[model samples]
Target: MARFLLIHGSAHGAWCYRELIPALTALGHQATAIDLPSHGDDPTPYQEATLSGYADRIVSELQAIGEEVILLGHSMGGYPISLAAERLPERVKHLVYLCAYVPKPGFSLNDRRREAEEQPLMEAIQLTEDGLGWTVGDDDLNRLFYHDCPPGTVDLAKAHLTIQAREPSTVSIETTARYAAIPRSYIRCINDGTIPPSYQVTMSEDWPSERVFSMDCGHSPFFADPTGLAGRLDQIARDIT
Candidate 1:
């Protein structure tokens, strides 16, 4: 069985994966999630959260595990996971992008988002006055992230979402062959409202078809379809081993 380290996206913490972790554990795999910096219960101030710091946190977790594990990233989490893998390739067995961004050389996550043809999330973003962080507007929260999620998802998210640091997304990353050599897979959410499904296709276009999978759900599959997501992950784990 593969051990998995799941990373949440912007403004979200490990709490977001509440359902998926147990689902994966039930399938005979070990899964763990962590709050990245200022998100969730972590006390790091938003202004101090940087992409490298996020990667460092992930690296520390991997070291604590003391074994190779599959590193999975959701949405903006792609950036940090990629950096972690690059920093400690031996600690990572595989990289999985779940409706997540796949970083490009010299391009920050924000730069990539800007390059997208459709900006579904633009209107939903509420930037902080200090220009250091941003939060999702309540009115667009369900529509953009939890449209197909379970009934109580929005309420749970509303109670837990935190201000996402902007520096992490704005700073560009440069990955080397160490990162490129690791096996990777991408899961595209077909009904995604936050990140367009078509753009997901474009992002993973060069990847082998076998490494790419699809889910007929929105962005928050952890809430929308945990079992289905688990099944997909199980299959990926088996394939990897």
Candidate 2:
């Protein structure tokens, strides 16, 4: 059995992995989903967080687990999880990017964001009145985030959605060749409006593992096809092991 650290995307917390955690546990693998500082239960306020803060939180939790783990990052969670794997290579068995960002050394998340040509969406996002670096809008959420999600689930997600910190998105990560040396995989959601398939292919090209797995769902496959997503994750663990 492998230990798995499941990191969630921006505007989401450990709450996003509710279905995934139990599924992984039932398969005999230990799993933990964390709420990045200020996003979930940490309660530090969304505007106050930075990429380093997120990465630090992941590393701290992994240390507490005291076991080697398969590191899984979704969306924005990819940034920190990638950095954590770079920081603690020994404890990471495999690095999985679930429709997540894959950055090069010294590349910030915003660099990839602009490269993905998502400036229109970014511009449409409305930040808090105090000028905090976070923004959200219903149209943006439905179109980019939960396009394929059930209406009811989408409503629930929107109701609970929090503004994402602009800092993490703007901060460029400083990575060594450490992560490239590790085993890596990408799970791409074919219908992901939030993250384009073309972009996924572009990002996957940088990795030695040319195998970019496909999912016939939207961006949030965890909600769209939890069973299938869990099954795919299990397969990856076996394949890497």
Candidate 3:
């Protein structure tokens, strides 16, 4: 069984994978999700969050694991996961970008978003007074990211969502050949409003066809269809291993 280390996106935490972990486990895989620094229960201050620091936490998780595992990054998580891959390429069986960014070397999430055709979250973003963190209004959050999600998922998320630190997203990730050598996969959400679907296609155009997947869902596929998401993940694990 492949052990998948799930990484959540901006403003979310390990709590975002409440349904996914169980679904993956039911499919005979071991899955675990952790809060990245300032998100969820972690007390790290958002102002202090750094891109490298985020990657360090992921590397620490890999160091603690008994074997190489599938590392799946959701949304903004792509950045740090790439950094983790660079640090421990052999520790990752496959690097899966779940409706997440597949950044170029030295490009920050901010840089990548600027290259997008649609800036869905542009108006929704509410930055902190100190310019350290960001959040979205509940109305925009529901419209943009949770439009296709099941009822109550948005509410559950709204209550738990934290102020996303800008430091990490703005900081460029330094990737090397080792990061490129790891097998990679990208799951594109076709109906996604948060990140344009066409942009996703453009981002992973160079990726091998077999590893690029498309789901008939919105931004948060893990919430929209955890079972389907797990099935896709299962297929990847099976094909790769």
How high is each candidate's TM-score? 0.99, 0.92, 0.98
Candidate 3, TM-score vs. the true structure? 0.98
| Best candidate according to TM-score | 1
Clashing pairs in 1: none
Comparison by TM-score, 1 against 2, better one: 1
Better of 2 and 3 by TM-score: 3
lDDT at residue 124 of model 2 (Cα atoms) = 61
* Model 2 per-residue lDDT tens digits across residues 53-136: 898898898899888888999988889998888888777888899999887667787788767744435656787777765656
| Model 3 C-alpha lDDT per residue in residues 77-149, reported as the tens digit of each score | 9999999899988899899999998888667798999899889999999989998898999889888888888
Q: Per-model C-alpha lDDT, please?
A: 0.95, 0.81, 0.91
Using lDDT, give the best candidate's number: 1
Error of 1 at 126 (Å): 1.0
Question: What is the total number of backbone clashes in candidate 1?
Answer: 0
Ranking by TM-score: 1, 3, 2
